[model samples]
Target: MTVKVFLATATVALGLMAVPAFAEEAPAPAVTPANAAAPPSAADLLFEQPQMRNAAPGSTITYDYLRRSGIAKGPFGAPLQDTVTLKVEKPTVAEKGGAGTPSADARDIAVTMFSGLNRVPAGPFEDMTGNPIVSLFFENHLRALAKVLEANPRYLKLAIRRGLRERAAVTPVKVKVGDREVDGWQVVTRPFAGDPMTERMRGLDDLTYTVVTSPAVPGEIVSMEAASRSKDGGELLQEKLNYDPKAG
Candidate 1:
C-alpha cells in the first residue's frame, strides 16, 4: 500500500496584523520552551493518536467548502474530473490553564468527510476496470488531514495518535511559513495485509495521510491536499472535504 501525508498552518507576518480580540486577559507566565516533542515512530504515530470527533456532540463550528475541477492525471493516464468538500465541526472553547481547570480556552474542533472525486476512463464494457474509485477515497482523506493540520496543530497530534493505533504510518517534515520553517508530521492509516472491505467492495490497498505544521503560529495549521491514480484508468470518483463549524 502507498501512503502520503501533508500538513500546514497559516502564519501571518507582523506586517499583516489581525485585529486583536477584545477579551480581557492576564499576562502569561514566562517559561523556557521545553524539549520539543519528538515525532512519533512511523508505526507508533499512525496507531496511537486519539479519535477525531466526526462532529462534537454539543458544540457548533463553521464550515468552509472548496471545490476544483479538471485535475491532471499522472503520465500515461487519462484526464480526470476532481472535487473536494470538507467539514470542520464541533468547536469548543476551554480554559487555558490545566486540562480541567477553569481557565480561558477557545475553539476545540473536529473535521470529517474530506472526500474528493477523480474520473477514470471506463472500459469498453462501461464498468470500472481497476481500483481508481477506491484510491480516490483515501486520497481525499489524506488531503483533508493535511489542510486541517495547517490550521490546528493540536488536531494533528490527536489525528496522529488515533491513526497510528489503527495501524497507520507517519513521518515528520519541515515546511516553510512566510519566512520561517516549522516541524510537522504525516500519518498513514490502513488495515494489515489481509483486512476485509465492506460487502459491496473488494479489498482496498491502503489509506495514508501526511500532516505538517504552519510556519507562523506553529500552533495553527494551514492547508492539505492529496492525489491518487491506478495503473489503468478505470472509474475515478472525485471527492471533496467540506468543513461546517455550525454542525454541533
Candidate 2:
C-alpha cells in the first residue's frame, strides 16, 4: 500500500534594514566599525542543545507503529515497525554550508524497517516507505522542539508558518513505555484548527496530530497519534518508542 504525505514550507522575513534617504547633494553619515552589530551567537543562530540527549551517537531507538486499513483492524493490523541507529560521525561540511560554524547539536541518524520481524528496505522517506515514515516523523519532531527551545522569535514564527504550524505548549502527561511509566509533555500540532488538504484519501484529512516527548530527555519523542476518517473514523497511525541497549 502507498500513502502520500504533504508538507508545507513557509518563508519568513527576518528584518529589514532602514536606509536613510537624503537630498541629492547631502552626504550620508559615516558608519564606523564600532557601530556595526556583531553576528548572532551559535545559540542565537541555531539550537545548540540536544533535544534528545538519550539518542546520542551509537545509541539505538526502536519504534513500532500500528497501521489499520480496510483489510485489517485492531492492533493486529498490518505490522509497521522500525529501529533507528544514531551514526557516530561528525556533520559533513556540506551540511554546515549555510549554517556557518558547526555545533554539537547536529545529528546523523539512520533507520531500518521491519514487517512482522522481517527486514524491509523499500526506499527513503520521499518514497513513503515505512522506515522513512518513522524516521522522518521523529526528525521533524526534534526540529520543532529545537525551535521552541531556542526561543528565537523569527525562527519560531517561521517554524509555525511552515509545517509545524503551532507553538508547542507544555502539558504534563504520563505514558507507559515498558513496565515503568514515563512523564512527558504532550505537544499538539495546530491544536485549534486543521489545515486543508489538496488531495483526498480514506481515513485522512490533514497531517495535524499530537506527540509526547520525555521532558527529562528533552527531545526524545515517546509516542505519536494521528486520526482520519474513511467510511469509519479510526486511528491512522500510532507509534511508541523503546530504548535498545543491545542494539548496535
Q: Which model scores highest in lDDT?
A: 2
Per-residue lDDT over 1-248 for candidate 1, one digit per residue giving the tens place of the 0 to 100 score: 11122221121000011121222221211112223466566442222222222222334322222332122231112322333222222222223333442212222322232234442232111111111212234344434433422323333334434444555544555544334455545444533133231221111122233333222221122223232222253222222222222233
lDDT of 2 by residue, 57-127 (tens): 45545554433222232322343444543333334544546445444554344555554454544333211
Query: Native-vs-model 1 lDDT?
Result: 0.29
Candidate 1: C-alpha RMSD to true structure equals 18.9
* TM-score of predicted structure 1: 0.34
Clashing pairs in 2: 51-219
- Most accurate candidate by TM-score: 2
**How many clashing residue pairs appear in each of the predictions shown?**
62, 1
CA lDDT for candidate 2 = 0.36
